[model samples]
Target: MEHEDAVGRRVYGTDHDDPSPGPRPGRIYRELLGGPLDGQLFDVTDWMPEDLFTGALLLAPLGMYGPGGRADYGPHEDDPFGPWIWGGDTP
Candidate 1:
């Protein structure tokens, strides 16, 4: 299986001497399918209510180059495990 790489390439805060802990438990990785953050892997592991997967979510567009907006995404209807489709954005 092909793995999806995260857009957050630079390691922040972690000490250079420490070894990577690897993937954490209870991590739910989902891909953002559109908008300025397209193809970005979003981790929705600790989202409340559990049904958050059934509704759209508003996320800050920090991943986009020179961000100044927000992106909205909804769960894909056909594939529950699929990428979240972009709904729109706000400036």
Candidate 2:
């Protein structure tokens, strides 16, 4: 299958934290989609020269950029790590 472009393609990621009822501590998962990886919780060891931002974005959340640019399935402070979307909204 042809992989989607890393830039806009959505990526779900989880930071290392203790698990909790709402959002696990170390397992704080979030979807990485759009914008740069400016607010990443973890370090992206590797990424293609051109795909650097793409890989970085995968490891972080959209909120890193800002509030308005955050993803619909937000991992933001208000809606952190939940309701992951694989293809559509039914997960």
Candidate 3:
């Protein structure tokens, strides 16, 4: 899981993280395999961490249903139209 970035710094562990209590095997499989969401959501709770970018990207679509359920892009909203360039000029 190691890679050299454009600037030559080594990057690793795109899939690795500090482990938590993780799922009780077979729970996630059953959930995605057409089970119910009752116990399903808790299954992978331990695997995910509090990452800003990844969390935002993942939850933005699902409308995050927790204490932060209200945080979401509106369903009728249009995609952002401009490049998010910083400290630079576009020509």
lDDT of each: 0.56, 0.29, 0.21
Q: Residue 59 of model 1: what lDDT?
A: 48
Residue 54: error of model 3 in Å? 23
Ranking by TM-score: 1, 2, 3
TM-score of each: 0.55, 0.20, 0.13
Query: For candidate 2, lDDT tens digit of each residue in 15-91?
Result: 34524213223332333333343222322233233432222212223344443343322333433332222211211
RMSD to the true structure for each prediction, in A, is 5.9, 15.1, 16.8
Q: Write the per-residue lDDT of candidate 3 for residues 1-91, one digit (tens) a residue.
A: 1111112221111122524323333332111111111121212223333221121111211233433222221111132221111111111
lDDT of 1 by residue, 60-89 (tens): 546342355667776877876667888877
**CA error at residue 68 for candidate 1, angstroms:** 4.3
Candidate that beats the other on lDDT, 1 or 3, i.e. the better one: 1
lDDT score of model 2? Answer: 0.29
Residue 22 local lDDT, model 2: 30
